[model samples]
Target: MALALLHTSPVHVPVFDALRDAHHPGFPLRHVVREELLAGAAARGPEAVAGEVTALVAELAAGGAAAVLCTCSTIGAVAEAAGSALAVPVLRVDRPMAAAAVRLGRVTVLATLASTLAPTRALLAEEARAAGLPGGDVRTVLVEGAWERFAAGDHDGCLDLVAAAADAVTGADVIVLAQGSMAAATARTTTALPVLSSPRPGLAAAVAAATRAAR
Candidate 1:
């Protein structure tokens, strides 16, 4: 199987690679990282973001990818909307995690980037509605100074900040890591609430979707 992953940060590559190796061994993976997408989304607006995602999805399909997974929460809606027009499946990496959050009732979504909060919250709402569940209370917490730590190449520090934030979250049925890059921090956190991250679940879904497409 050939799965293409669209990421807004290069940090997600190794995380996805390890997950893919452990879960879907022998599957060929193609990674496309566009750091600009994350940095420019707010200034570019939704329409521009949608256009960029649409083009990227098409490009991935043309490259013989059976499925494309968008790993950026900020552009998740755009990728999902673009999927309707493509034969190959296009999925947002956070979809499975978002749906899981809805099922858990009250979800607290944590993100290092402020841009991720709105889309992650929106996705959880959409999933809840589609599942015929009562709209759950989805809260967002932006980890202070986390993005700066990441910008400074302090990967461990950034992850520690995220895990610390997760550890402190209370009164939620689940804690959701809003970005693929945040998935690594999940292992280091000790939380009473279930903490969910995108990579493993997302790649599992991608493998399934690509398998179906191949058939």
Candidate 2:
């Protein structure tokens, strides 16, 4: 079965490709990237943002995708809500990460974009509540000045800033990299705490869901 990934940026292409090769070898993939989707969502209101995500999900469904993974945390809720109306599973790429974080108790969500922190925290809270996990403190730490470097294509520098922030985090049961783009930074980080990134867990969840649905 084929799979489609809706991304807000091309930065995640390589990461997803590697992940697909490793986890779901030979699965045909289709990627639809709207580099400005997140930036545009800011100027647009909630309805517009939801509409954009819904439309993307529909397109993926129409393209024969057995499942769709929305790889943007900021618009994750919209994608998930849209999933309810579709036959195929449409999952937020961070859904698994959020679920994992909830089980870990004290969680620190690390992000480069301030916009993602709120939604990610909300997702973690929602996941925890659903699982009957006790309400735990979920804090957010934004890497100062990191987004600008990423916007400018200095990915190495951006990862450096994120790694520094991850290294400094203490006392959290788990550290979550808020964006799929930030997943690469996990390799650079050195910490005793479990550090979670979205791509692997999220894609694995999507594959499992899609496979079950197909059967």
Candidate 3:
């Protein structure tokens, strides 16, 4: 079955590319974006800035999509609300990352997109509760322009920014790459701690959901 993946930036293309590259026929994928969708995710409050995502998802559904997967980590609630509103499988990419991050106990989420961290935190808290794990002590460090470099194919520049972000997560047991696009440079990551990316977990869940729905 085919899937419709939506995002607001081409910066996230690497993520969906990796997902489809690994999980082919079982999860054939297509992507669409509206650049303006990311306008406030790096600045305004989550509720105020990220609202455009849900609106766009609503529009994507009218075109006969079987399920909707939102790619932006910062605008998760808007995506979550859209999922509930549409009564379809609406999987926000960060939900899986947040759920798994909390399992590592004291964890730090390295987020380059500043605007989306709040809702992403809420998703992490919810994941903690579902796991019956104690509430987590989570910290966020934002790396400015990291995604831009990665999308531009500046491999070294992306890793350098991540190395700097790593310093922010020093005390934590694990550092979760807040942006899936940033996962491309995991090899150059200097942090000794295990680094987690959003795509592996998020795509796993979306594949499971889409598979079940297709069956």
Candidate 4:
């Protein structure tokens, strides 16, 4: 059985591919990238793309994908709701990371996109509830100008800003980098607080779910 991944940015293709190769070698992966999906979500909100997201997920599941992973945080809730309706395993990449964060007490979330903050916070709250914890104490920080730098192809500049934002955070038990692309910023942060990013844990969960479905 193969795992399917839905990504908004082409940058994530190689990142997840490499992760799968190293940790789950020989696993089959099908990647679908549609930049416009994220653009639409950012412009009009995730609900605006609910129909399309569900349709694409249904198509992938029907095509023999054991599990589908939505790597875009902006549209994650919609994708997950679609999965529930269709009886397919549709996992959001930020979930496992959010689960980890909720367990750590106060969480400070850092994001480059304005659209990512709400979804990430909501995911953390959901995870907290699922874990039988009180709704989490979550704070969101937007790294100003970082998204523009990323869009302009200045990846280093974007990450630099993200790292700076992470370093400035305080009174938090952990810091969560909201986007998979922001994972690189973790290395650049000097904060003593644990920093969490979705890609590694998320992909691992996807692999496990696909394996279970294949059985």
Candidate 5:
């Protein structure tokens, strides 16, 4: 059985592919990139494209994916909802990061896009509640102009902005990069506070889920 990944940006293809190669070599992966999905979510709202997102996820599951992972935070909740009715596992990439953040206490979330902020915040709250922790101390920061750079294919510019934003953050036990695309920024950040990104831990979780589903 293969693990299917639903991504909004094509950049994530290489990122996750490299991750799988390094960590879970020989694991089967199926990637589907729908830039329009995130485009619609950003232009309108995530709810506007909920049906399309859900349909795509159902299609992936039906196509023999042992597990489906939504790598976009904007439509993660909707994808997860669609997965609920399926036999296969459907996961949002940010969930593992959120679970980790809630345990750390006082999380500061950094995002390049305004659309990702609310959903990520909600995910953190849900994770906190599930873990019986208070969700009051989480903070969100939008790195101005970073999304524009990312959209223009300037990944380095985006990472620089994210790293700078992370360095500027204060009074937080840990910092969470709201988007998986921003995961590389963790290495560039100068702050001593722990920086959490979804890709590594999230992919690990997906691999484990796929392994179990295959059994």
Candidate 6:
């Protein structure tokens, strides 16, 4: 399926690629992201961000794209607005992911990008409550310097940072990796609970929604 994806970080392209490879390798997928989406997430707030995404979705729809997936988790609220404006299926990465993660109580979200972690937690908490766990625990552990190392091409360093954050998730029933870019190289640590990352849940939703809409 063809999808026009808006994202702030370009690293997520590989993450989504990995997800497609894992779950939907039979189908061809197209992905796009701009660095501005990540760097400008805080600066423009919702209106400006939503305007940019809405514009992108409109263009992709014009070009015969099957769906729109916004890759940056932080900008999902904006994507929600854009989805309302766009004609094609617009997949916001966070909501469905939050839904799946909420099914497990005592969720821990490991995030390299600290800027997006708070919202990730809030979304998880809200979903958990709605899913029947009113007092579920949600935790966030920042893997210090993970994103920096990845951007600097120190792939090993990125993995190391993610591994280090594993300590904070020791008691979690559900461990969620908030950012998609880190999914590819995130080093695994022992977890008795379910581990939810951006790639599978988000990519699955995108593929499912796009395929269904196209059908």
The whole-model lDDT of each prediction reads 0.88, 0.86, 0.73, 0.93, 0.95, 0.72
What lDDT is reached at residue 120 by model 2?
A: 88
CA RMSD for every model? 1.2, 1.4, 2.5, 0.9, 0.7, 2.4
Q: Give the TM-score of candidate 4.
A: 0.98
Q: Return the top candidate by TM-score.
A: 5
lDDT of 2 by residue, 1-215 (tens): 77788889998888888998998998777888986779866556334688878888998898788999889888888888998999999989998888888888899989998878878888988899999987469889999999999999999999999988999998788999999989888899988888899999988888877777677
Q: Write the per-residue lDDT of candidate 5 for residues 1-215, one digit (tens) a residue.
A: 89999999999999999999999999999999999999999999999999998899999998999999999999999899989999999999999999999999899999999999999999999999999998889899999999999999899999999999999999999999999999999999989999999999999999999999999
Candidate 3, superposed: residue stretches over 4 Å from native: 49-51, 144-155
Q: Which lDDT value does model 2 have at 139? A: 84
Tell me the tens digit of each residue's lDDT in model 3 across 185-204: 56667678888887777877
> Against the hidden reference, what TM-scores do the models get?
0.96, 0.95, 0.86, 0.98, 0.99, 0.86
TM-score ranking from best to worst? 5, 4, 1, 2, 6, 3
Better of 5 and 6 by TM-score: 5
lDDT of 6 by residue, 1-215 (tens): 57666767666677777777788886667667677766676555545566677777778777887888887777776676677766688877877778987776677788877767866877887777787777357777888778788778887788667765764467767777787666644446554556666767777888888888788
At residue 107, give the lDDT of candidate 3.
77
Show where candidate 5 strays beyond 4 Å.
Answer: none
Give the winner by TM-score: 1 or 5.
Answer: 5
Please give the lDDT score at residue 205 for candidate 5.
95
Query: Once superposed on the true structure, which residue ranges of model 4 sit more than 4 Å away at CA?
Result: none
Task: Identify the superior model by lDDT, candidate 2 or candidate 3.
Answer: 2
List model 4 lDDT by residue over 38-73, tens digit each.
999999999999999999999999998999999999
The clash numbers for all candidates, in the given order, read 0, 0, 1, 0, 0, 2
Model 1 Cα lDDT, one tens digit per residue, 55-156:
888998998999999888888788889989999999998999888889878888999989888888788888999999986687899999998999899999
Clashes of 3: 1
Top of the candidates by lDDT: 5
Please report how far candidate 3 places residue 94 from its true position, in Å: 1.4
The segments of candidate 1 whose C-alpha lies over 4 angstroms from its true place after superposition are none
For candidate 1, what is the TM-score? Answer: 0.96
